[model samples]
Structures are given as structure tokens and as C-alpha cells.
Target: MHFDLPDLRLFIHIAESPSLTQGARKAFLSPAAASARIKALESQLGSRLLYRDSRGVELTPAGQRLLQHARLIMRQVDYLKSEFTEYGTDAAGHIRIFANTTAVTEFLPEVLAGFLAERPGVTVDLQERLSRDIVRGVLDGAADLGIIAGPVQAPGLQVLHFSTDRLVLAVPLGHALAQRQSVSFNDTLAYQHIGLHEGSTLLSFLREQVEKLGGNLALRIQVSSFEAICRMIEGGVGIGIIPESAARRHSRTMQLAILQLDEAWAVRERSMLVRELDALPGSVRALIDRLKQGV
Candidate 1:
């Protein structure tokens, strides 16, 4: 039995996306065309691949097995293209990275800007995820690299120290808690909070902490970036938990107060994870080096 690369790619997209229509759009195929192709593939394999429903599609057991092999093949194909770039080929390189909220918002922008400027032929798809999810994404080959925080437990993946990330409480200058040097997370729960948008790793972590303490986070507003959260806090809309770097930087120009968190989880050691370091493409490796330099 022969499996076509395009068919496998389409299947991968379908498995990753929420719906067949969205997957078809990603693969640049009309819905009918995508369905026909999947039918043909299922016929060739003599097994059902996906479960269709009104909500979305779910992969069958057979589909999961196929997805494993498909991802491996696609990764190899990408590596092949990247390797050719070393031999005077103009094949563009693409790197996928999954990172935590702090790395995404505070650390990566400047570093990626410089890296992308220097390598016009290289492209990066950077996503923000929980640190645990970042590890899973890298280990599953969904991302070429992952930037994680706090304790790491990736058994076989190569890990490197990235940077230190600390969480802090930001309040308006005249707020009652502003005079405090530090405070427990639960202590701040009584006041309204400016939080990062939903799905942010930091927000998720804060929610988890609040749940553990049997308290609810009183989120006054949810903003897209740490800077926005700082702005909201400065305006006395609410106080917020944000990275120390962001709180410090914004405090210089905004009427905000930075208070250290008293919990052990507040201070995190960030690290980078890869399935294999030497196996990474040259461009991906170079970007890793740049990150290590804190540039």
C-alpha cells in the first residue's frame, strides 16, 4: 500500500484541527475534495480513520496510529528540506516553538525579531501554552522546541536552562496593598484583578492556585498582554499578577506598584526542551543559541 505525502499532510491537519472544514481550509482544499481524499485514503487502508459528528471530528484508533507515522514522516521531510539549505539550496526553513506566557510575552519578541531579521529565509511559528503542554508538544513532535518554566520532568528530551521568570503583584500606587513588600496570592484574591486573556499559562496557573486555596480569583478585566494588564492596574481598574520583568518595566512609566509574591511557585526557572539537540536543523539550533545568550 502506498500513502501519498499530501494525503498524509491533509490527514495530519484534520487530526489537529477542530473540524474537517477547518482542516480543509488549512490544506487549501475544498470541503468536498478533502472528504473524497479522506475516503480514498480510508479505502486504501481498509480502516475507518475519523468519527464525524455535529461538533467536530474525532480520530479513531486507526487514525491515531496513522497520525504517529505521519508526524514522523513530516518531521523528516522538513529536516531534509532544512538540510539542503546548508548546501547552497534556497529551501526556506521553518521552526515551531511552544513556550510559556512569560517567554512568549517578555523574552521571545526581541530575540525572535533579531533572529528573523538576520535569517530572511527562516520562519518561526511560536505559540504560547502551559509549561506542561509545551513539554508535551515538543515530545509529540508537534513543535520543534519548547520553552518551559518551573520544574521539568521530560525523561528523554534534551533540556537546557533558559532563564529565570518570577511572578509579582502589580497594584496602583495608592492602592491599599501597594505599601506591602510582598503578599500571598490568596491575600490578593479579595481585590479585583486584571488578568491575562483566557488560555494564558499564567492565568491558568493563577486559577489553579486560587482553586487550591478554595478561593475564586476576582478578575476585573482580561487583557491580551502583560503591558495591558499593567496599564489596567495603573488606572486602578484592578491589581494583577504578572511577570516581574513586565511589572518592573511598566512601573517606570506607569503609576504602578510592584510587590513580590510570597509563594514558592512565584519564582520559576525556565528551560528549553528539544527531542534531540544535534538532530535539530541549523536554523533551529542557531535560534536556540540566540535564546541562550538572552538576546
Candidate 2:
């Protein structure tokens, strides 16, 4: 019950090599020392663990069973070393995280909260920027990580799919578009839109959609957040297109209707972007893993 790791490791080494002399050499012990150690281990276990002959050493049944458990124990020890190694660093680190409005509003707050909770030693500098700007921030080394909507053009950037979201039109309960289930992006253009600020990703995307469809995106007002846009819709100010996740949250608190859009470009894929994988520090790599897990 109190046997040392060296005994278990030597048992595995001898079992693998089938030669006490060769296994002892591999374990950095003399043959005489290896033989004495095995005898002591066998005496402690109350069972013979090896068959030694001119051919070399072979494991008895007990040695095979010990080998199985020893492998499991070694794996757990390795995991403990890997998992606990990061906690040894006392220096505080900051990760510059840049994300678009949709991800910042709809998804990442919860993810970041959990990541920060588990990693108290690290600080996150979260910034809201457009997807293009997020890419620029990473490329310019201004940000360590980026979460942005795709159809992105970052030739040298490493990216992974983070989440999928769609832009939907939200309207008041008795509004003209409420009775219908879906509407084309162009068809909704006639109605005034309550949107985010002019430079927001959603606003820029809407403007792009309007130009591609040859329609007028009649924007009558602009707000800072999706909740504000939904509140404007609830007050009968005007209907607006917002992320489905943000729309769902506001719908619970306000009398708003979610209308799915009839356009193919409505679904937006969000991705995590980095300059290079190996360039990141171990702690930063762990942060990326946590983000990938949505932790």
C-alpha cells in the first residue's frame, strides 16, 4: 500500500522490455539494484511478479495486472501535472478580446464570466468592434483574440467557428409584420428601421443587404444596443432586424414578435480569430481552449 513510484515504474519497464538488465539500464539503474528492487517489491506485494531465465524476464499474471493499474496511475499523474502547472505562475496576464456587437450582446458575456471565474489570475480586456476591425486588431497585434461574424477575409489568420446567429425582424405584437411568419429583406425596407449606430456591424450589414437587393433601408433612428432596438419596436417606434439571440431575450421582457427573414444572407456565422496558434503563451492557449468550450 505504501510502495514508491520507482517500484511501479520499474515493474512496467521490466514488463515492457522482458529483460531485467535492459529495463534497469533504461530506468537508469544498475542490474544489481534493479534485481534487489524487484525482490523487495514482490516481497511487499506477497506475490511473485516475474519469471527470470536465460531468455530474459517475463511477467507473471500479477505483474500484468499491476502493469494495467500502473498505466492508469501514470496517466492520472500526467494529467495532474499538466492541469496544475498553469496555477504555478504568479504573474497576472491580460487577454485582449475583441468582438462584434452581436457576439458581445448575445453570447460572450456568459462565456467570459465563466472563463474569468475559473481563471482569477487573468484579466480580460473585452472591446466591442466590427468584425473587420476585430481582424485588424489581431493582425496589428492590438488584440490577443477575436470573435467576429464571417464572410471574413483574413488571409493569414487562424479561425474557428464559435457560434451561428441570424438577423431577424422584431416588431410590436399588433404591428403590420407581426401576423406574418417571414418577410424578404427588401420587402421590409419600406418600413422604417430602428437600428444600432451607423458604424455597427448589424447596421453595415443591413446597408450592404439593401445595396445588393436594390432596396431602400429606411433607417429612421439609431440606438446603441439590441435591447434598445427591441424596446423601440415594443413602443411602436419602428420594426428592426436584430440577432435572433438578442431578440429572444428582449421578447421575454417586452411585447415583441420575432419574424424570420426570407433572405439567404440572414444567417451569420461567428468565428474566433487568432494570428497564429503556437505564437500564444500557454496561459493564453488555455484561455482559447476555454473559449472554444464556451466555458
Candidate closest to the true structure, highest lDDT: 1
TM-score of candidate 1 versus the correct structure, residues matched by position: 0.91
TM-score of each candidate structure, all chains considered together: 0.91, 0.67
Candidate 1 differs from the real structure by a C-alpha RMSD in angstroms, to one decimal, of 2.4
Q: State the C-alpha lDDT per candidate.
A: 0.88, 0.79
List ranges where model 2 is wrong by over 4 Å: 1-91
User: Which residue pairs in model 1 clash with each other?
Assistant: none
Q: Write the per-residue lDDT of candidate 1 for residues 1-295, one digit (tens) a residue.
A: 9989999999999999999999999999998999999999999999999999999999999999898788878987998788887533322589999998888888799898978887788889999988788888887788999998787899879999967878999999999998999999889999999988889888888898998999999988899998899888888899999888888888899999889999999998888999998888788888888888863
User: Which consecutive 10 residues in model 1 have the weakest lDDT in total?
Assistant: 83-92
TM-score of 2: 0.67
